[model samples]
Target: MKPLPSLDVLKTFLVVDQKLNFTRAADTLNVTQGAVSRQIDGLEAHLGYALFARQARGLALTQQGALLVAPLQQAFAQIGEALAKGAAQSGTLRVKCPTCAMRWVLPRVICLQNERPEIVVEVTASVSHGVDFSGEQFDAAIVFGTPSLKGVSTHHLFDEVLTPVCAPELWKARRGKMPTPGDLAGKTLLHPTRDRRDWLRWLNAYGYEGLPSTKAQHFDTLDLAISSAMQGLGVTIGDLSLIEEDLGARRVIAPFSLCVPSGAAYYLVYPERPAPSPALQHFAQWIEGEARHTRTHLAAYTKPIHQPIN
Candidate 1:
């Protein structure tokens, strides 16, 4: 078998051959003339043939050098093409999630992206009502609801438990009385406009027959809703997982012992038709693993409590 030339040597030879001057080639390559000369020398020794003829005028390619140029150029061209294709394939994976989910999931996603840099992620907050996955272009969506939509692949991420949260001052101001559905009649109710179903379901399950004409405040996003609650505007029912940080920080407090098991669950949904991209598949798997970790961690630290909404 013939001895293969080193890539560095071939690169140096190609540059020198094109420029027809060792000094110019060395300058272009940011290498010393002596280094370029040594590379040519090493290349010639390995090939057992002189590739360049040194002359008073400049460097000229010998017969062997001329013969090697075509194939070497072709090899480098192929390598460049492959690298370009690979870079194009390693694209960003767009993901959609609600603002509340983003607060919890973004950190996890950052860790995943760091580990798998080849897969870029673009997270967009979806504030619109319903799972409008079709309206937007996203590789995957993390939605809060049961897997009821047909023709979509849904992976149950987590079950949500709703707790009524209000500013700590609001709870204290209530004067030791746990607020009931009747008490909420005059008080402001900060509601998430994205999914009214959540509040409706809670109201139904609690046997609130007459819908109260209460002072209502609507927020287009969860963050806004939570912020409103924090400012002591009104009580907001929020997912336990999402508000765990707030509860720990004493930013918000559960005033009433009444809680509702939200029928909604977080699900990772993707199109059922075409096969998922490799990046999407990797992300889905990582999310499920993270969910498992969260379940285990929460189980150890927190005790499950059911608070019925009155």
Candidate 2:
């Protein structure tokens, strides 16, 4: 425990590491580029190692700098989440979730807000997969996969099963004969740009390999792809958690008993801190309860029970 660098220096290092451009980091910190440079120099002298390397693109972390990134992120994330608690209504809570959750969770959040107007919660949307909570200023994130990120606490929301979903009219068009996974061969399939692998995985499970991969329509988000499915344009593989409302409303149905796990699951993510912050605790309890309701709906909808039971 020798003389360590201050929080300001560490924060500057993190921003520079995150952006890899001192100028951009300076703009974000509301400081001059020269000040940013000086901070880095002083920090480097304190630690007695070169923290960055000059490259054509920008500053790259040296081995020493690379080692510090995760720990530094954890330290700051804890501080930020703790402070965010005090900053909530007394200090506002900023939450980040991806598109699919945005559609499904917004109403629930509003309900939570209504119940507890005392807490101020702000929710923002992003592509949760591979998103860096460290730089996003998020007190928490509802991400599409398990918690692998360094600085955040992750909770299992639910594991996803990709179910082939299509409009009720499309199923009815088949005229009462139950549709099977093999039936997808003759129909258009919708693909979400981010999780297109689910389509291939499901196709392989059903042995529908001969269909041309490009035959499917692709959309940038899962919400868009499912919307296309609801219009009777085609069938899309849906994570039941995301499409629970549509399934319950009879807007879409899984045509077969077959459901394939996407090998990824939804997780509740927030920056790592020693103790639970007030805001984080409030949101976690509320969101986990919402997810439990969703899990039950997800389980019920993946079956073709909407069709006449045999």
Q: Which candidate achieves the best lDDT against the true structure?
A: 2
Query: What is the total number of backbone clashes in candidate 2?
Result: 4
Q: In model 1, where is the ten-residue run with the lowest total lDDT? A: 128-137
RMSD of 1: 20.6
TM-score of each: 0.56, 0.71
Off by over 4 Å in 2: 1-86, 130-133, 173-176, 212-214, 302-310
lDDT of 2 at 15: 86
lDDT to native, each model: 0.72, 0.76
Model 1 Cα lDDT, one tens digit per residue, 1-310: 9868767778888889888998998776767999999999988888889999999999889998899988887776566445434433658777788777876688888998789888888888865323533324566788886556555788877777665678987754467565666766766778876456556655666667644545778877777888899999987877766665677788988755545666566888876645576777888999998887766644522344544433
Candidate 1's TM-score: 0.56
Pairs that collide, model 2: 87-91, 87-92, 88-91, 88-92
Instruction: Mark the regions of model 1 whose C-alpha exceeds 4 Å error after superposition.
Output: 1-88, 114-116, 129-135, 148-151, 173-187, 194-200, 203-213, 272-274, 293-310
Q: Which ten residues in a row are the worst by lDDT in model 2?
A: 301-310
